[model samples]
Target: MSKVVLITGGSSGIGKSIGEFLTEKGFKVYGTSRSPERYTSSKFPILKLDVKVVSTISDCVQSLLEQEDRIDVLINNAGVGITGPLEEIPLEEMKSHFDTNFFGPLEVIKAVLPQMRKQHSGLIINVTSIAGYMGLPYRGIYSASKGALELVTEAYRMELKSFNIQMTNVAPGDFATNIASGRFHAPVNENSPYKTAYGNTLKLMDSHVDSGKDPKIMAEAIFKIISTKNPNVHYKVGEFMQKFSVALKRILPDKMYEKLLLNHYKL
Candidate 1:
């Protein structure tokens, strides 16, 4: 039987591309999305799913279970981004980001783990971001969401290794995805309590969205990881700045990194 792979948020962006690439390689692809209409001409199943909705995830998984008894891979790729001064974000906004980006994946894991455990073999890929490893200006919540996921992936890899099931954390750099256009952006006001501290950096980040890495590159990387026999537990894929940024985050002291970030953005 052909293997089955499921990707959340697969209507477009990296997930959509991964679905297409994987389908071409003979995997029975399941692409879950809130807006299935946004994706067209894929030779795989496009299921209506919204990660923020637990029922949506469960119903989608349950439907798949009835048609196919096994799911070989689960790509926890659905996420939402909230941008604003971390200080000014409403508590609910922060919680919602966590809901879509972190908790949502956990829900999917629980829904799918029974089958994976029964099979005694599976791969779970968590789509993270370089920001997870390094705090970035105006990217605090997104960074936090990915950071939380990274740690969880590590723990899962350690725990699941013996079971022959595996976990991989993919930290992709800035990429050309609808995430920039789709994120919830809190209106900024210098007079707002936290804006004065992060406004400039946020502005810079907003401007860079147009010229980051390509979504296809990220998709190709994800496809390879899913196909390979021995993919790394942690994979970083992107342009030079992101690589440099991650390296600096690892080598520099927190205060020094702060200084560099502030000076780089003229904050």
Candidate 2:
């Protein structure tokens, strides 16, 4: 039987690319969106799900189970991007970001665990960010949320090992997608101290997304990971420099790595 896969936020961007790719590879793919009605023409079924809403998460899982009987893979791909000076970003917004990026994924995983455990086999892939590995000037909250998820996955992997269920994080660098338009940007206020730096950094971030690699690359990476018998705890997919930055952080002194970031952002 073909593997049954579920992907959150699969209506577009990286999720959509992965869903389409897997569909062509002969997997039974189901993607989720807040507004599934809008994606009637999607290659695979797009179920209604909003990660921030627990009820929707449960409903999506139950509905899929009724149709497919088993979920071989669960891709926690639903996340929103947020950027701003940490101090200027609203407290509520930070909480909301975490709710979507961290807590939301956790809820989805919980919903699927019973079935995965019953089957005595499954894989859960958390789509994290390369940015999660470091705290960039204007993207600290976004970094923290994803970073928290990364650590949580590390812990979950150990707990699930005996059940033959696998959990891993796939951190991607900037990928050409509609993420920039959907991302939250705390406005740059003229009177605020961070206005100049925040504005410049925000522009740079958008440019990176605009020129990023094709999302198909992420899809291919996902496909390869699913085929592996023993997947690593973490996998990164991105440009050389982006992946190198993580390696550099591991070897460089604290202040020196900080300096590199400051120079890159021209702050």
Candidate 3:
């Protein structure tokens, strides 16, 4: 039997692309969406799932296991983007981003881990962003959320190693997707101190995303990660500049890195 794979946020974007790619490769792929009825794809089945809701995540996984006795892989790919001055963004709004981007994936991880433990082998991939490596102006909340998830993945890698379950955090740089339409744009009123700066930075961010790498590259990376016996702890899918920026942040002086980032955004 083919390995069973479950992916969250599979109705569109990177999630959908990965699901299709895996399906084409002969894996039995199951993708999730809160509203699966809205989208359709051949070779992969869409299941109903809302990552933020623990009960829904449990139900989805249970349903999958009922149909197929094992879940060989769990891909936590559901996430949202939020942008604006962190201070100006409402606390509730920031919570909403975390609910989807951080906590949501955690719940899904918890849901599938029991089955993985029983199987004594499984792969879990968390779809984080390069922004997680460094805080970007106007995208502070989004960065925080992805950053949090990356940390969780790192911890889980060690915690679950005894169970033979592997965890990998895949950080993609700006990707060509409809994330702009779904992102939460925090309020930036005239009185806000970072109003102009937020606008300029947001514009630059959008431009970068518009010209970002294709999603297929990420899907291929994921496929390889799953196929390998011992995949690296972290994998980045994007242009050299974005991936290199992560290394740069680690080695460069704090002020120097900040200066380079500010210069890139023209801030």
Candidate 4:
């Protein structure tokens, strides 16, 4: 039988690309959306799921299990983006961002674990961001949330090893997607102290996404990882410099790396 795969936030963007690619490769793929009805034309089925809601996560997993009888792979790709100065972004918004980006994926993983354990084999891939490796000026909240997930996956890999389940993080750099449109942006208030700097950084961030590499790059990387017998704990997909930046952070002094970021954002 072909492997059964579940992807969260698969209605569009990177998740959609992965689902479609896997489907063409003969994997039985299912994708989730907060509004499934909106994606009538998707190549794979779009189940209704809101990662922030435990009940929806449970229902979606149950529904898929009922149909496929097994979930060989779970892609925790459902996440939202938030960009703003740390102080200026509302506290509630920050919490909400965590709910979707961090807690949501955790809940989905929890919902699927029992079944995966019963099968004695499974793979869980958490879709994180390149920004997760370090704090970016305006996208601090996004960095924190994704970064937290990256760490959690490391712990999960050890715990799940005996059960024959594998967990890994795939952090993608900026990809050409609709993420910018959906991201929560704190209004650029003219009188706010961070108005000018925040405004410039925000524009630069969107431009990067606009000119980002194709989503298929992520799809290919994911496919390779899935086929590997002993996958690494973390994999990054993006432009050479974007991936190199992570290495630079490891080798550079704290102040030097900070300076590079400041210069890049022109802060």
Off by over 4 Å in 4: none
- Per-residue lDDT of 1-267 in model 2, one digit per residue for the tens? 999999999999999999999999999999999999999999999999999999999999999999999999999999999989888889999999999999999999999999999999999999999999999899999999999999999999999999999999999999999999888899999999999999999999999999999999999999999999999999999999999999999999999999999999999
What TM-score fits each model?
Answer: 0.93, 0.99, 0.97, 0.99
Local error of candidate 4 at 240, Å?
Answer: 0.5
How high is the CA lDDT of each candidate model?
0.84, 0.97, 0.90, 0.96
lDDT of 1: 0.84
Considering summed lDDT, which 10 consecutive residues are worst modelled in model 2? 179-188
Clashes per prediction? 0, 0, 0, 0
Residues 1-267, candidate 4: write the lDDT tens digits: 899999999989999999999999999999999999999999999999998889999999999999999999999999999998888899999999999999999999999999999999999999999999999998999999999999999999999999999999999999999999999999999999999999999899999999999999999999998999989999999999999999999999999999999999998
lDDT of 4 at 45: 99
Cα lDDT tens digits for candidate 3, 1-267: 799999999888899889889989999999999998877644588899998788999899999999999999999999988998877888999888899999999999999999999999999999999999999888888888999989988898999999999999999998888898899987668888888888888888888879877888889999999999998988888999999999999999999999998999888
Q: What is the C-alpha RMSD of each candidate to the true structure, in Å?
A: 1.8, 0.5, 1.0, 0.5
The total number of steric clashes, by the backbone 3 Å criterion, in model 1 comes to 0
Check candidate 4 and list the clashing pairs: none
